[model samples]
Target: MPIDIETFDESSSDELNTLTNAEMVVRFLATNDDKAYTPSEIAERIDIKKNSIGTVLSRLEDRNLVRHKGDYWAIGERETVRDAYRTHRIMEALDERYGEEDLEEWREHAAEGE
Candidate 1:
């Protein structure tokens, strides 16, 4: 189920505020594969400056959240796995707020050959 608009009203801004530079990096990694991504790629993908991505990457690397592999930036040994299912729940909630009408359940409810 997609997130409903009513749910958006109940959401806390603090949750959004909790996203930091490293978290941004983590989210990007989570969005992509388990391979090593260069700082340039991150900057391009996230629309952040290359220098800023570099700094964030350095911090994440130091904290063991990411590690360098054979020309790839892979998740570090200490990196904690994120729950993709939970993210789906969050995405559903947001979609509801945005008034998205293409939700699967809603499509199933549509009339035939109207």
Candidate 2:
């Protein structure tokens, strides 16, 4: 079957819009790491304020969702590697309809069953 891009944008929810900038940042990190992203690569992906990514990374570290592997980030011991893989799947699914910005916005909506 052909991929239909509209599926990701329609049937959304309020919770998605509720995702704070920090949460959005975590989701991005979670997503890229699943795709085997490097810190430099993730740095290239986000256009947030200076040190914001660092703060988010620090927070993820505190939450045990990610760890610093030398200069790169790795999945946490307590975190589910499959979760990263799942986000990658969702990224592939929605990429046709949404750009990076839209995907970030769509997260909570999709999380809420978009």
TM-score of each: 0.49, 0.44
The global C-alpha lDDT for each of the candidates, from Candidate 1 onward, is 0.61, 0.56
**Worst-scoring 10-residue span by lDDT in model 2:** 1-10
lDDT of 2 by residue, 1-114 (tens): 111244235324442444544555555555455644455555456545545667777776786677786667765653454575467558856874675566576787888884
Local accuracy of candidate 1 as per-residue lDDT tens digits, 20-109: 566656666755655567778766766667778767777777866676755456555532434533564578688768865676767677
- Steric collisions counted per model: 7, 2
Please give the TM-score that candidate 2 achieves against the real structure. 0.44
Best by lDDT: 1
> Which runs of model 2 end up more than 4 angstroms from their true locations?
1-12, 35-40, 77-114
